[model samples]
Target chain A: MRLFRSTLTALALALPLAAPTLGLATSAHAAPYTIDNSHTSVLFKTTHLGVSPFWGRFNNVTGSFQYDAAKVDASKVQFEIDVNSVFTADKKRDDHLKSPDFFSAKQFPKITFESTSVKAGKAAGSLSVTGTLTVRGTKKTITVELAKTGEGKDPWGGERIGFEGSFVINRLDYGVSYMPEGLGKDVTIVVAVEGIKG
Target chain B: MDPILALAFGVVVPALVALAFVVVLRRPFARTARGGETDLPAPWAAGFGLAAAYGIGVGLLLGWPDLPPVDVTLVAPWAAGVAAFLGLIRDGRVRGAASGVLGLGLGVFMTGPIEDMTLRVGLIAGVTASMVALERGLARLSERLDPRGAALSQIVLVSGAALAVLFSDTASLAQATGGLAAGLGALFTLGLLWPRAAVLTRAAPAVAAILVTNLWGTTLFANGHPAVLAALTLAPLLVSFIPPLAASRRAILRIAVPAALIGIPIAAAGAFAGLRYFATEDASASEHATGPTDPTSPSAATPATPSGTPTTSGTPTTPGTSGYDPGYGY
Candidate 1:
């Protein structure tokens, strides 16, 4: 009985030591990180009349990402942007855009991006996330360059990860061809995401 | 091919078809009406030419594999075809004001397939009201005009509208309706003046009415605040009243007066087509407007998803936020 008790105590002690090895063994497993809205910014800019640059951002953005630092290729991201949340700061223009001429947000409420593949880019600490970006019911495959800025614990004791990505996409590809002169066709999207470790 | 060449190719099919129609069927329908003989080919020839060119011809070119890149929709051709077909029916058999009402209904509903049906309805209704007012004005100044002047003036007016549309935002619409309007306008201009063809020009107004509706209906901004097109529709009719006031029969004055009158509206439409653009949203003062933010600005963040999954948005504004330019509803 005493030997069994001793074995139980040693086993319990060893388990904690082995727990880190278990974590290392499963290091290939992805960490599911929820996007931290308070620290995230999603922005896009396009040329005005094909000359000067203009900017717009989606007010309501939601998405989660599965990231494996060791297996960088396995990291994946998906975003669902509320297209109706488009805020250009011009009410008339916003109404016009929300109308059929542009986004048709009522018909297509959400713009989605789901990663298809991930590859470590040639640049250090960067990943090329190729994904299908759907807008206004049209989908196109695009590669967004996501660079890791840093990862650490916060003062609130919450573990968090940081990343920023950018890509240029043609609005025409998604059939938002209204007012071509008023609104440029090529939109540059820059997303900064601070994901909290779950 | 060059633009001129494209225009040539685009119009060639309808022109040939029209030539064949006028040349081949001249004798049978060349028979005089009860009133007298005329120079215009039968009414069917003009209708066929307009429909064939703007309708089927435009359709062919638009569908062709190798054309220069252009961004446009087929709404113009489709609307023009319905107008031409209906106008032909009204001219051919379904006579009177009821037919005009029916044509207007058909024309407005045809725009249902397009975006912003409400805006389209406004354009058609405004054009209708403007045309009606012009007709009443012409009635008050009957001594100055004859059927030939009225018909030709309408032809000129519609042709101008088509020109405006051609020069406007959409290229495909320009080619399609422009080519066809030119053909019909030329046919009417020649035929109405020709003594033997006057019978063929008998119902040109009815034809122009429906055809003109398509010209505006297919446009992106068919109805703007100044209502330029409504003004264009009224210009020729208003000009017709001027000559009697001057009490002059002088041909140069007659020609110059009408030319100047028509030029004003044409220029207006052209300016909107070429110069006007919706002011970008960025022009309005916004608390967030810190001079166009860079696409790669790292201050972005998205909030958490409803599913409890974390999301990111940088400098995040609360959801359902609002701020925008209130200067214009247009």
Candidate 2:
């Protein structure tokens, strides 16, 4: 009876000592990352006249992410793209894209995405993120399959992580239904982001 | 811009539909008025047709607007519907009040949700006054200019507005205006084909409402130049400047003089728009040649202001080896 009591006393002492270590291990997996705008790019390609793919991009993107490599489903991400930042080389076309016919930048300034769910993707180090995407006041759920490009420390002593994802969406579904025949409905969007550990 | 699509959807189809609707409804509409007066006293029979046909063209060209519209583009069809409804009332005072209400509502709605209270109130008063005045002005013009002259004036005004809006870098609104011009063209063409059926009394209120609201909408929502749109608003008034036409004067001069008078402001507006467009293009080219001085500057993030000029200096990456063309196909 005396030995049993002694062992019980030892077990209580160890539990308290190990609790902080377990907490640290859990917190290590949940890291915050701020998007590095200079290195990040949000590119899109839409078919022009049904003949070829026309490429364009948004220059201003800002967002952050919470990543848990150990539990992919626990990761969450959000991004805001300035609709006015749409760049298509041709100023006239860019203006049209920002007008009421497409993004309506003056009325709906920001195109945003916030992840609702995340799941393990088919490939290793990849995640399938489902999010509510808002464009021109219309909100729709869209899924993006993202592959981890790399994770490392930069020369400046900042920890960095990168991801690349591609997805297809119907512009018409988002109420950008101008020129139904001249411009293709389906647009392929590519997002490549580099984040600094915050 | 797809010229073929714009021509087909914005011009041809709407024109045909409007022409048919005007021609088919003439006798039936006249019968309704026969019991009351020598002609149709009801104002909406033809107005509704024009508004409906224009709405259809806007739908085909730029998809029908969403419920509880957020922008002018979405509100355009609804405004047309409201204008057509206003045409149904035979009482001039009541119609005028209703038109005033509509204009006030549009002035508040089309400016988007962020306009300050003072600006909103000013817009409301301006729009209300303009709507009442234009309705009365159109009524007088219809009586004095006759049906053909009135229709031609509408065509010129809307067409000029379309071209000016186009150069403002808002193609969808321009296309919508183009559709309206085509609908008016159909009305003018019907008068030529069947002189006995040429009746525009019913179409006056709707035409006035659509013209004023569209001009205001383009100027406020779509980056259209205020001066240019204002000139368009006053172009029709120029017809009033031409003294009463003598019966001995050439019959063709009735249409020709009014058309020429109204064309002045439109031509000037178009010229101004062209110069502005080219100036912007030149500035853009120079910026591209110089290239961006700083990749990470805030200037890189900021886009063009709502002055109908895009000043960003993004150098497009060349599509290499794939033979892909990102440049203008036309």
Candidate 3:
């Protein structure tokens, strides 16, 4: 009778500790963060004809991220870019880019990216994120260098995080082969995004 | 700036210049067939100027990124201009639409617009045959149709096509329409301001046909629907069937009936095109995305401004793949 009572007491004591350990394991994996589009921007620069490079950006971008500082490999990120929000300062140039020649904003309204894998990058505290980027219905796997910018508490005490990265892509590879001779095939994209814990 | 702004100025400037030309030349050349020294109505000069304005002004806008390739729109107007010059030859008349056909054919051949030999030749032959046949039938009934009435009809039809082009985000093509509108407007203004000096020539429809068919080719080349151009061309010919009246009320009836015939269908086509464009535009879809900004849905990021207005950022390129030509297999 005493042996049975002692075993039950031991199991009851371990249950509280075990439950916390399981919860901690999940918390360590990653936390969901909503991308604050107002503070995020995507910039791209391309050679005009091997003579000069021009820069442009998408104004409206929204996405979410599953990120953990300790478990970087388990993180995932996704983004949706409003293709019609392409702005290059000059309205005429923006129109040309939005046209069927480059992005075909009407045919493909969104440029999207979803991460499939991530690993430690070359730089310290940086991650190499591999994702499928879809533009104009054509998708290709691209790797972007995602460096952790910072994390802190906002004025409202909400947790905020940020990332800054860049990568190069071929427009032709994305099926944007209009005036190939007039515009360089390769385009360089830069990204800076902030995430607010929801 | 909106492309409409550029297109508008492209027209206003040339129209002012053409008007000035008419006024300047009026003192020297204004005369009637009845042998009176009146202000001149230079149909040939006005027609040539009108064609030139649409050709050069709109061509520059359309060919910005297209490099040094010849386009049919670039040449067809000049051919019509040549036909208009024939109108100056003191009765060196081109029967019906023959002048326009010859001009467009020569224009297509000399320029060698597309690399595809079969397509280029086919367009040239088809447009020429269709246009010439239509104009010839109308020319046989020219006695009942007045020149002013015909000129007015051309303006109404071209304006309809222009509105449709504008809605399709085709700035350059829209500019071409703007130029044609300006030309016809110049002719009408001159007719109204100096009635005796107005030179409404018999060759106006044929000359105008070149512009219409060029637009027909352009719109079909860009967008598959050529009904706007087809409707534009057909309505004017319907005006020719208006009966000739020898009564005192002949002047108003002759002008009014033909205009009404041409204007109604053109209006219908323009309105339909506009409705269809707005229906399919991405902005409309975005507008309905008015629910809560769900963090789960990435599309919620779309800005409200683009949905409500004709944004400059989303306009398409000129002619795009519609102008794509694989080299001839010759």
User: Top DockQ: which candidate number?
Assistant: 2
Backbone collisions counted per model: 32, 0, 3
TM-score of chain A of each: 0.83, 0.87, 0.87
- DockQ ranking from best to worst? 2, 1, 3
- TM-scores for all candidates: the values are 0.49, 0.83, 0.50
- All DockQ scores: 0.09, 0.25, 0.02
Q: Write the per-residue lDDT of candidate 2 for residues B11-128, one digit (tens) a residue.
A: 8887877766666655566767676444332335557767776788878877777778756656767777788878778776687778788878877776655568888787777767
In order, the candidates keep a fraction of the true contacts of: 0.14, 0.21, 0.00
The candidate that wins on lDDT is 2
Error of 2 at B274 (Å): 2.1
User: How would you encode candidate 3's per-residue C-alpha lDDT over B122-234 as one tens digit per residue?
Assistant: 76665665465445433432345554555566566667767766655454456666776776677666666554323445445434555555555445433325676566556
Q: Supply the TM-score for candidate 3.
A: 0.50
Chain B TM-score of every predicted model: 0.58, 0.79, 0.66
Q: What is the TM-score of chain B in candidate 1?
A: 0.58
Give Cα-based local distance difference scores for all models: 0.55, 0.73, 0.61
The better candidate by TM-score, 1 or 3, is: 3
